[model samples]
Target: MKWEDNRESTNIEDRRNSSNYGSKGRGGNMMALLPIVKILLGTKIGRIVLVIGVVAYFFGFNPLSLLDSSVTPSSTQSKVVNKDADDKSARFVSAVLAQTEDIWSEVFKKYGATYQVPKLVLFRGSTRSGCGFASAQTGPFYCPADRKIYLDLSFFDELAQRHDAPGDFAQAYVIAHEVGHHVQNIIGTLDKVQKAKQNFRSEKKSNALQVKVELQADCYSGLWAHYSMKNFNSLEEGDIEEALNAASAIGDDTLQKKAQGYVVPDAFTHGSSAQRMKWFRKGFTQANLESCDTF
Candidate 1:
C-alpha cells in the first residue's frame, strides 16, 4: 500500500492518554466486564464503585461521564499531544480517513448529494465515546450517535498475532470497515435495521440482522478499496488477499470457536467465515454501492 504522499484527514482527534482510560461502551449490564473489570479493579465490586467515586471526586464527574469521542472539528485544529508513540499510527489513520473522504465525496456528488466526513479518534487503553466509554478490546467501532470512528491501534498487533491477519492493508481494512458503518449511519441504513430489530422473533433472529449489518460493512470496505486502488496507489499486489484474510480471521464463528471451543450461530453478531469472505469479495468485485444494500 502506498500512503507516503497521501493527504492526512483534518477530522482526526488524537487523545492517546488524556483523562480517559478504562472506559467502556457496553453500558447497562456489563457481561464482558466479569473477566476484565473485576480483575483490574480488584476482585470486589465495592472497590470498583469506590474507584468510580474517587474518579468522580478528583476529576469531577469522572471527567468522562459524558465521554463523547466525537471531536467536532472547529475552525482551529487541535494541538498535537500524546503520552504514547501513536503519532505515526495516528498520521496513517488520518491519511486513510482523508482518502475515504475523497472517495465518498465524489461518490455522493454522482448521486446529486453532498458527503459529510466523520471524525476519527485515536486513543490508547480507553476513551469515551458518544454512547459510552470504550476499550481497545471492543476492536474498532463507529458510533453513529457521534458520527465518529474509535480505534485502538494495539488491535493491529492482536489482528496479526491472534487472528493471523497480518498486513498493512489488513490494518487499513479494519479502519475502513468501521468507516463503512459510518456510511450506513449517514444513509439511514443503521436506523432502519435497528428499528426492524425490535420486531425480531428471537435473539437469534436479531443477531442475524447484525450479521447482515456487518456483511454490508465488509462490502462498504470494498467500496473504499476500489477508490483507494484507483485514486491512491494504495493497492499492492497482495493487499486484497490480506484484507480477505482479515475478513476470514475475524469471523464470528472463528472467534466463538477460539473463545469457547464451539460455534454458536444463535449468538453470532457477525457472520461466518464463508459469508464474510463472500460479501467482502462481492464489494471488491463490483465496487458499486448499489450492490451493497444488505439492509
Candidate 2:
C-alpha cells in the first residue's frame, strides 16, 4: 500500500482525454434510435407511417433500413479531464504496473528468459483495443493480440461500491491478475488454452477450461503479491484480506448469485468464490510456479 514513493511505469498510454464512445454491440444502433422513434411514434402522421412501414415490412420492403443508415455512431466524444483528480489514481496504477514489471522480470530471469514488458493503456469511457472496441463496461483486461492491458480507473470505484471490495491492494490485485494473463500469453499458456478450447464441442466443457485459465491467473496474481511483499515490503495491515475479498467478490458464483439470485456452475467461466480464494492462497503460501498449475 506504500506505493506513492514507488517508481511509476513509463509504459502507460493515457487516452483518457480522447474518449471513443462508439459501440458496435448488438442492439446498440437500435438503442441510439430510441429517442427519434419515440418522437415519431407520438405524432399522428407517424402512426400512419408506422402502419405503412409494418405493411411494407411484411411485403419485403424495409423502412427501418433508412433510419439505420442515417444514424452514425459517435466515434469521438470530447471528455474534459480533471488532471488533478485523476493524477493520484493514474500514479497508483503506474506504480502497481511497475511492481508487476519488476516482479515478473525477476521471475522470468530465473527461467532463463527475458521478460517482455506489456504496455498498460488508460482510457476514459471507451477506446479501441487490439481485441476489439472496448468500453468501461468491459472492465480491465489483457489483450493477447496487442500485448497490452486496457483499464478504466472507474472500475476501482465500481469494485468498491458495487462489489464491496475496496482498498489499494484490491486495485493492485486487479492489475496483477491482468498482468498474469500477459504472463500466460508470453509463456504460451494462453495459446495452448485457446487451442484446447477450440477442440471442445460443448460450451460447458469450454467454460470449464476457461475457469482453469482464470484460476491460474488468480494464482499468478497471488504470486505477484508474494514477490511484491518480499521485495518491497509493500503490504500493509489488511492488504491480503482486501485482495481475498476482491477475489471472492468477483467470483463467477458470487456475481451470478447477486445478479440472478442463483448460481450455475456449468455456466461459470471463472471459478467459485472458494476456488478463487484457495488458488490465491496457494500461490501466496507456496510462492512457486509449480503450485500455480491450475490446469
Candidate 3:
C-alpha cells in the first residue's frame, strides 16, 4: 500500500490507449451483419448470400463494410478519457508488480531455481490475450499459454465498490493471487491438475480439483505477503484484514447466497469463505510450501 516511491516494474504492458475492440472494428462490423445474416439464412437466395459473404470474408473482403456507420476508424483509435486517474492506477500496479517480482525471485532462489518473471498486460475495455480475446468482464487472469497476466484497472474499482473490499492491499492481493497461478504453472501443479481432471468424468469431482487449485493460489498469495512483510515491512495495520475481507467477499458461498439465495457446495470452484481465510492464514503463519498443500 505504501508504493508511491517504490520502483515500478518494467514488465508492464500499457495498452490502455489502444483500441480495445477487434482489429478495424471487425467485431462491431460482425454485430451489424448478424440481423441481416439471420434473415437471409431463412431463404435459398439468402443462403447463397451467406455463402458469398463467407467467401468474401475468406478473400480479405467484408460485405459488412458496405454498411454505413460500420467502419468508424476514429472511434476505434480514440484516446482514453480520465487518463489522469488511470495513470495513477497504472503506477500503483507497476509498483506492486515490482514487489512481487522481487519477493518471488528470492523465494524461487531458495528452492534452487531461477524465477521466470511473468509480464503483466494492462488494457482498457478489451484486448487480445494468448488464451483468447479478453474483455473487462473476463476480470484479472493469468494466461499460462502466454505466461502473461492480463488486468484491467477498472477491476480494482469494482472490487472496492461492488465487493466492498476497499483498500490498496486488497488490490495487491488480487495481483498476488494471479501471480500465484503463475507459480503453480512453473511448479507443474497446473499440469498435474489438468492431467488429474482428465481422470474424472463428474463435474463435481472436477470442480473439487479446481477448488484445490484456487485455494492453493490463495495460499500462495499469503505466502507472498508473508515474505513481503518480513523483508520490507510493507503491511499497514489493516492490510491483512482487507485481504481477508476480500477473500470472504468473493467466496463461493457468499456469492452464491447473494445471487441465488442458497449455497450449492458441489458447484464450488473456489472454497467457502472459511476455507479461503484458513488456507491464506495457514500460508501466512506457516510460511512454507508444505503448509500450502490444499490437496
Give Cα distance to truth, residue 35, candidate 3, Å. Answer: 20
TM-score on alpha carbons, each prediction: 0.79, 0.81, 0.82
Model 1 lDDT, residue 86, Cα: 54
**Separate clash counts for every candidate:** 2, 0, 0
Q: Model 2 residue 164 lDDT?
A: 100
Q: Which candidate is the best by lDDT?
A: 2
Which is superior by TM-score, 1 or 3? 3
Residue 74 CA displacement from its true place in model 3, Å: 9.8
The better-scoring model by lDDT among 2 and 3 is 2
How high is the CA lDDT of each candidate model? 0.80, 0.87, 0.86
Candidate 3 lDDT, 210-282, residue by residue in tens: 9999999999999988987887788899999999999998899998998999999999998999998888888
Segments of candidate 1 deviating more than 4 angstroms: 21-85
For model 1, residues 107-140, the per-residue Cα lDDT tens digits are: 8898888899999988766678897867776878
Query: Distance (Å) between predicted and true CA of 163, model 1?
Result: 1.1
Identify the leading candidate in terms of TM-score. 3
Better of 2 and 3 by TM-score: 3
For every candidate in turn, the CA RMSD to the true structure comes to: 9.6, 8.3, 6.8
